[model samples]
Target: MNLSSKSVLVTGGAGFIGSSLVRELLREDAEVTVLDNFSAGDPSHLAGLDGSLEVVEGDIRDSSLTSLLERKEVDCVFNLAAEPYIPYCYDRPAQFFEVNANGTLNLLLACKEAGVERILHYSSSEVYGSAKHVPMDEEHPTLPLSTYAVSKLAADRLCFTMYHEQEVPVIILRQFNCYGPRETYPYIIPELISQLSKGPDLQLGNIKARRDFTYVEDAVRGAIELMKCDRAVGEVVNLGSGIDYSVEELSHIIGELMGYDRVNIEIAKERLRPLDVERLQCDYSKARELCGYRPKTSIAEGIERTIDWFRENNERWIWEVKIAPSERIWRKDDGC
Candidate 1:
């Protein structure tokens, strides 16, 4: 579908990645409508973006999404809204199923009813769990360990099921860890920047765990590129840097960039997830072949950019948010 002049609905458009996608789509001249509950997404992320855009405060689980699609004459839908915090899923497992699984079902049904031409559903790399092999591909065995991963896997499979059984024009875009400015959660990147900015001493957990971190802008570019590729429909494609880095390695690099003098690091039990995936590396060969997807940002450059953003935007929550690494069971706190 040619995105230019097309009507697009981006659920969770106020989110980190979603907002970035909105910006790119607007540059493509697509009329965009954003649906979000504002639970984790902040309206300020969408600020200063010029486009034919509308923001709606709503949930993906709502049945009324069909009417909204029809009313807006939306040509395509991008589903990014979900309960994405891994630790939060531990306490509210059912909420993950409700939002990530059933909520996706709602959106698919609405697309069918509204005759939306295509829908791109965002799936997480966590669904793949630890890599049984290096550079996990789309066919990687399903071995989700956490409640969050399980819920995402459920929704991931749901998108495939709808595509095959109901003929829903859907595509599953499974992206790996994305980090950049305007991030809502205190993910490793933000947390590291947050902690490193304060002092040289660092407290972290699962430092040996490895992940493929894709910069937010690169991820957004890949999503838009896939949306324009008709062949990507009914397919699941991976978007990532195709390079993995351990948390410990990441910390040292950030420390060097921050110019820390003999940095001190310690393992903090509170920061550990009970069933954390030890490693994840993406195999985006399918995406590369189908849509010419290539992640342009290197980890060092991405981190540098992120650090610069935080440096300039110190008033952001990440700078002031209290990180209780010493507390037992350090709950995911925004420190708002």
Candidate 2:
């Protein structure tokens, strides 16, 4: 689907990656309607969008999605809405399953009813779990270790099933560790940035595990590229950097990017996942072959850019972290 002058519906457009994709779609002058419940997303993310962008406050689990799609007459629907935080999923598996699994079923059914073509579903590398081999590809055995991972795996397979069984025009684009500005949950990058934002010491867990990180902008670009590739319909592709870096190594690089002096690193047992995936590296050869997907932002450059954003918006993250730190159980903080 050519995005230029087309109408697109981006669910969860107020999120970090969703907002980035909204900007990308707006650059092409596509009419966009963003559907979000603002649970973790903020209206501020979509503040500067021109008349081409429409913001709707709603839940992906709601049947109103069908009405919205019918009204907008969108050519494509991008499902980026889900309950994705790992810890949160552990605490409330029912909630995560409802939003990540059943909520997806709701949206896919709506898309089918509305005759919306080319639905791009957001997937994650967590579905691949610990890599049995280096640079895990789409064929990697899915041994999901966490509730969040299991929920996403269910949703990812649901997309494939919809495509094959119901003939729903759908594609699953799974991305590696995604990080950038407006990132609510403190992953390694934001945890370091937020800690530095307030003070000096960085508290983390399981720094030995390795991950393939991808910047938000490049992930959005890969998603859009996949959306346009006609051959990608009913297929799954991995958008990864094809490189893995340890959390400890990433922390030092982040410190370097932030230009920290005598950085204090502390390991917090509470911050670690109950069962951690040892390593994940992306084999995006299929992405390159199918959709010409190449993540442009390197970890160094992306960290620099993300640090710049944190520096500008220090108060927002700092205040939020102070209210509900990552060590404590996840809370529904509406401040941001």
Candidate 3:
């Protein structure tokens, strides 16, 4: 279906990738309604967008969602709301399931009630845990390692089951590690950038663990394209760069870009997760075949863009960055 002039609802639209998706949908002339609780999302991310945008500070688990969907006459829904912080999940595993799994069920029920045409459920690559093989595909065995991954996997299965049982036109888009501007959390890319911005010395964990990082814009574009393709409904697709980079390599690249000839690397146990996925690499061939999707941004180019954003908006993401050691690790009580 064409997105032009369509009414779209983006859950968690105030977030990093969600905000970027909201911007792109507006560019397509789609009337956008953002439903976010601002738990991990920032209100300022939606600031200064030129479009028919409606912002709702609400949660996906709200009982009023059906009424809201009907009132707005939303044509499509992009579900991105979730408790995504990994370390925090260890502290509150139940919250992750509540938001990622049960909350998704609530949205699905609302869509069923409101007769919403389509729903693109944003899932995470963590559901696959560490790769059992190179270039993980949609059919990869889902052996999630952490609570966050298991919660996401539960949501994914919910979407798939809902599509078959309730006939809710749902597409599960499993997005790999996404990094770009407006990211609130202290993930690897943002964390490294934050540290490097301050000095050359870096403290990190599991530098050998590899991940396939996809630029936010590219990931959003892939989702939009899949939504536009009818064949993608009731299917799971992977969105990624089709390449992987180790954390150590990523740090060095960031250091080099920041004009640091050599940066001090300190591997601290406090930064390591007990149940960290060792490696992640995406196989997006299904996306290519179904929707003619291919990631357009390279890692270096994306990192440069991210660095530029952080440089211009230091106050936006600068905060007391926290990692492992359990004590310093982010908890659910820690206000996002």
Candidate 4:
């Protein structure tokens, strides 16, 4: 679907990746309507987007979403609405199933009803679980390690089912760990940046585990590219750097970039994943070949950019400010 001059509906556009995509769409002069429940998303993330977009405060599961699609004359739907936190999903399994699975069902039905020509579904790499082989590809076996993973896998399959059975023009993009500015959650990079700003000493879990982290901009570009590719319908592609990094290494890099003298790292048992996937490396050959997609940011460059953003918005990291006085003092002295 040519996005130019088309009205696009981005569900959860106030969230991290969705907001990035929203900004991109607006840059192309495409009319955009953002539907968000504000459950895990913040309106502050949409601070710079003034009148260029319409904001619909609602849930994707609600039938109101269908009405919004119809009333707004939406040509395409980008479904980025889902509970992404793994531990949160484990604690609230019902919410996870409802939002991730049932919510997707609702959106697909709405797209069908609204006669939406195209749909892009944002899925996660967690659905692949621990890589049975290096550089996990789309054909890799999906043995979800967490409840959140299971929910995402179900949603992903639902997209494929809709394309095949219901004749919905849907494309699924399984993104790996995406990090950048305006990311609110205590994700790895944001969490480390927040902690490092408090002090050099940081406590974390499973430092040995590695993940394929994609810069948010690169992931957004991949999504846009996939949306433009007509052949991408009924296909699944992985969006990632195709490189993995350990948490310990990430901490040291972030600390150094933020000008910290020394980073004291300790393992926090309570913070560990119950069934941790030790490693993740994506095989992005399909994305490269199909959508002409390539990650432009390296881990070091991405971390540096993220650190700068966090430093500029230190007020948002208030929870990380509650550490020991000595740690706080250290952070203050180090210009964090």
Candidate 5:
């Protein structure tokens, strides 16, 4: 599965981690085609790449993804498409299942149909509800606490069974908390950053919750390396920072770096999830042994980079604050 000059199809390739993977693919001179519905991904995020980068605007559930895969002469597929926002997944569980679970089936069938050489299917670390043990590894029990996590875990198993029964070469990476430019989800880091950037008070819920945050670049790097590793097929591996940071701790760090010492932290009742997973910390040693994965950026460095991105590109994520608050708190609820 040598990626150099190989034809590759990356579904949801315009997304935060996906876009970063797209850049890596282009740098490696792989013929790349990006498929995204723009439901949670912004096309504008992929503003610059050209000459070996092809963009397809479509959904994974539709026949369009299969059709594109058939026509693209692709050697490998990277399945990164999902309805991943936690709060939104709770709001629309059916839609989340439709996209994350069923959509994965569509892509797996397409890959099998196309006889693709390799497929890297990404699952969320949220699939592991909380740390039953510190430094949770590949063998951790999956006790998904949210609809979004359930959908991803479903898809994760789907990929595995399809590999065994259907003989599709699928690799699953249960990615931990990933953050960077163009991250669509309103996770505590991004949401809190948005709130603190625009105003003095940072309104958040479940501040005690903790997670292992991985920078987007490191996550993408690991994914690409896994694509080239033969042992990665039919394997479920975790990709994370291996260190947990509480939301409370992150608020002060982000505030300090952004030079807002006076930023007030207030609990926003509406922002809390129905059943929150309390904590997550990754043990990516299997990934290290298999694909030489070593997450280089520390949390401090990653937060600095993320804050810099938000400061530079306020307009893109500012919509998050406006739309989210208005929908949940400020706007009057009137059934249509």
Candidate 6:
């Protein structure tokens, strides 16, 4: 599991967290290969690491991925490829199943065929929707409230099954809300920042819902540490900052940070989920004990970093704005 001399494949390496992970791996001198279809991902996000990493522009569900893995002599596989947006999953459940669930199946098969030594499957805290208890841990009963959550949960279990039956060295990390630069999705913090910058009026849905927001860098660091921990095999670890904040509170904070005295808030019915999970706060004791993983960034610090990045890369941020509105609002009649 030592990555120093290993060859790694990071699926969906062009996306938000995956791109960050790719950069870290390259810095550590690992021979990296990235497989991304550019569906919800953009290759431009990975421009800095282009020369150091091999890029394969193809879908994870394609049989070609197996061949590519075998030819590349991949030592380890990190399955970060997924349809991450909840509302998009509601609008396109079949696509969600095809990409998140079946795409995971394809990657597992490819890993097996390539004799990849280890695999780290990225999962989400949404799998433990509406936390049945405070500080939700790996042992919490999973009750996914969205199709996206359900698909990710299914993939997480698939990794567990692969480890038990197929003997693949696979581990799962149920990541909480990870946010940072190059993340174009209209998640709470980014959405609030974008809206506030546009004007004083910010429209959203379910402001009272809370989430455990982990910095993207922290989540990526935790994932890398877990990949080197042999004891993590066949285990599910939660990656989070062990903090929670309501969307309402987060928006207000962003408004203040942006120098706005006050901001107008509006509730748009179309922005609400059909079955929204009210709250999520993680229990990161296992991650800390196992891999010495602790979030190094506070919420305020992380928000400031994200805001700074957005401001510096305003053009890229603005281009992404066009894709955001459609990406955020869920529609039942959209042929999911």
Q: For this target, which candidate reaches the highest lDDT against the unseen true structure?
A: 3
- Clash list (residue pairs), candidate 1: none
TM-score of 3: 0.94
Give the Å shift of residue 22 in candidate 2.
Answer: 0.5
Estimate the TM-score of every prediction.
Answer: 0.94, 0.93, 0.94, 0.93, 0.92, 0.93
lDDT for position 103 in model 3: 99
Candidate 4, residues 1-336, lDDT tens digits: the string is: 567789999999988899889988888778999999876666777877744688889998997777888899999888999887777666678878899999999999999999998999999998998889989999999989998889999999899999999999999999999998877546888788878877899999999999999999999988988998999999999989999999988989888988887799989899987798888899999999998999999888988887787667654532122343112111121224
26-144: candidate 5 lDDT, tens digit per residue: 98899999889776566777887865988988888887666687798889999999876787776678888998999999999988888789999999899999889989998999999
RMSD of each: 3.8, 3.3, 3.8, 5.0, 4.6, 4.6
What tens-digit string does per-residue lDDT give for candidate 6 at 1-336?
A: 668758899999988899999988887788899898776667787885633588889878998877888888898888889887787676678878888899998889888888888899999999998988999989999999999999999898888888899998898989989888877746777778778777779899999999999899888989999998988888999999999999988988888888889888899999998999999999999988888998999888888898888887664332222454434222111100
Error of 1 at 24 (Å): 0.7
Candidate 1 RMSD to the real structure? 3.8
Name the lDDT of candidate 1.
0.87
Point out the worst 10-residue segment of candidate 6 by lDDT: 327-336
lDDT of 1 by residue, 62-161 (tens): 9788899999999999999998778777777887899999999999999999999999999999989899998899999889999988988899888999
Model 6 TM-score is 0.93
The Cα local distance difference test for each model comes to 0.87, 0.83, 0.89, 0.85, 0.83, 0.84
At residue 26, candidate 2 shows an lDDT of: 94
- TM-score of model 1 (CA atoms): 0.94
Residues 1-336, candidate 2, lDDT per residue (tens digit)?
A: 689888899998988789989999998788999998866677788887775999998988996888888999988988999876677677678888889999999999999999997899998899999999988999999999999999999999899899999999999988888888777656677777766655567788998999998998888888898999999999888998888999888878887776766567799999888899999999999989987888888889988887787666544432122343323332433221
How far out, in Å, is residue 63 in model 6? 1.0
**lDDT-superior candidate, 3 or 6:** 3
